[model samples]
Target chain A: MTGLRLAAVLLAVFAASFALAQGDPRRSGYREMGPALQKMQDDDAANPAMLFVQAGAAAWAEKAAAGKSCADCHGDATASMKGVAARYPAFSAEAGKPIDLEGRINLCRTTHQQAEALAPESDGLLALSAYVALQSRGQPIAPPDDARLSNLRAEGAELYKRRQGQLNLSCANCHDDHAGRKLAGATIPQGHPTGYPIYRLEWQALGSLKRRLRNCVIGMRAEPWSYDAADYLALESFLMQRAKGMAMDAPGVRP
Target chain B: MSRALAALLLLLPGAAVAQQDSMPSLTGKPGDPARGRAIVANRTVGLCLLCHGAPIPEERFQGNLAPSLAGAGSRATPDQLRLRVADAARLNPDTIMPPYYRVDGLTRVARSFQGKTILTAEQIEDVVAYLASLKD
Candidate 1:
């Protein structure tokens, strides 16, 4: 080929790749992890998140002061909770807003079990959420099609694009504009929320999606919203809806 | 140096402190290019390689999020380089690059990172010197 033709071909290739990075065909963070981490996530025996799941199992059976364990109301989580996590950040008419899987667990604690709410990212909370989420592993994410969620979900979509912090970056700047690109040694995943209560290698423990969101806000050098902030639920609602139909990989291992 | 000591030094007579401005040396002395290069190459500390590609061959994976550092010296003056390293937001508020020498005006910074800039004034000078040396 002539020099001009060769240049044209290279430009087309570059443009195509850039488009692919910015557009979807969405991928899970799991697809971006290294083989070792992938193996760690795949093997139930090796996944560190399972430790929290085990703890959650114990909590599920233990009766609260009101003499009701989660088991009493829900029964055998393996049967009762399957696919439940996939539909979370569900609308709660009692609270008059959406609530994440963690929030739902807390709601159950206060109302059904007559137990005190677990602190955000607390060991007990992580364990219980992880356990509940594990039941939905591999199920396709199916956000509720409720109209009450529309406004909050829109606010979340706005927040995702709005830039803030010392870095002046929006979630879309890195996760969408430059997804699949390198951020030093790390590959920037597309910021999907398929997994929750994941075992982050950096954290060396199981943590909720809210914890990850808080970390990202800090990374952007922005003030993180409080744990119970409507913004967290809004973002969660938006992310689940955005990731609708993707497989749930809760209690996931990540680096 | 300990951050506490660095903080102490900034309070001393000749620190030349300010997140804005391009004229003054942050440490009031010419930075060592060798030291600057080391900081740029460090993944956990400097994190420069996380966004900008430099001519550091030993580093297996350099970033592609920003312009290559290959001709940075040829492209910008030492003062301009210092300003960009210290606080690029002054030039472009929407830039994704963090303010390496800025400490004030940030909201709700984490406990560990609170009251701390991403890079110290001395380190900013060092990074400037290193970028200045990359003429090619």
Candidate 2:
């Protein structure tokens, strides 16, 4: 081959390899944690999230204002609620958009039980979210293939790449570009939403995905979206889609 | 009057630096390399090691998210370093580095950090000096 042709072929091959290297393999944040934290997540007895799960279980059976409990309509959670969490951020026909597991819980409360919606990050909300999420502990995340969700999911992907705040960073900059690297003392994880209602060491309590998302925005010195905002729902849908096929690690432990 | 003004300036931690690509020394005095080194090495204060790998041997897990701080002295002048450290967004609008000396035009700044720059004017000088000394 001519020297110019040979060089052109080699350049193309190099470019392909570089692109492959840039594509991050899908990996859960659980694998990025320390052994002690991993062990804490692994053991149900040791997991702090279990406390919330127990509370949720109690709330599930208790009669609400309308004189109906969650169990009254759904029956045994172990059988009925299995794999439900894995398919969350589902298209809510009533809301005309996607609603996450927490949203679903609140919707059930307001509509079926005639109760007020639980406040964001409240003990009651965290408890029920943890309890329901536990049922799908090891199921692979399966975002629904509803065409109605296409727009919000796309918006979410755009938000992930959009730079914001004083620091001018996008989610891709830290979670995608710098995953597996250290930022101060902590390693920047790939930031998959495999875990929700996670037990964070910094928080000393269980918190939802919305809470985690808000913390990230604050860290970037940006104004966080309000609770149950469509933007939050969009991001949650995108994260769930991005984490497709990754096992659910709800009530996860993190430092 | 000058004495009162100087005292008032002392109370304000992060006095304004010129809004330019290259800026004069923030403290109007040459920075102390030793003090600069201390700031760069500090995990919480400077947070330089969080994004840039520097010559600090004690810090094992230096970040690789941004450029290495090694040979920074040769790459840019002291004036350029000052501006980059104070407000890098002026140079690159999408830079992830936080503005160490700028205070206004930010959104939703945490309650404790409102109206406060990330670093003092003197701290910015120290950081710039430390970065300017990384010739090798």
Best by TM-score: 2
Q: What does candidate 2's lDDT look like per residue over A1-255, in tens digits? A: 699999999999999988865674888889899999999999999999999999999999999999999999999898898889999889888766678888899999999999999999999999998999999999989999899888989999998888756555678889988898878667898888887889999999899888888998887767788896888888888998999888999889988
Q: Poorest 10 consecutive residues of model 2 chain A by lDDT?
A: A161-170
i-RMSD per candidate, Å: 2.8, 2.9
Error of 1 at A131 (Å): 1.8
Candidate 1 clashes between residue pairs 3 or more apart in a chain or in different chains: none
- Candidate 1 overall lDDT versus native: 0.86
lDDT, candidate 2, B1-136, per-residue tens: 9999998798665444333558888779888888999998886788788888888898888888789999999999999998888888888876778888987767556665677787889888888888889897
In candidate 2, which residue pairs clash?
none
TM-score of each: 0.78, 0.80
State how far residue A60 of model 1 sits from its true place (Å).
2.1
| Model 1 lDDT per residue over A1-255, tens place | 699999999999999989967785899999889999989999989999988889999999999989999999999999999999999989898767788888899998998878899999999999999899999999999999999889989999998988766555688889888889888777999888887889999998888889899988987768888898988888888888889988988888889
Taking chain A of model 1 alone, its TM-score versus the true chain A equals 0.90
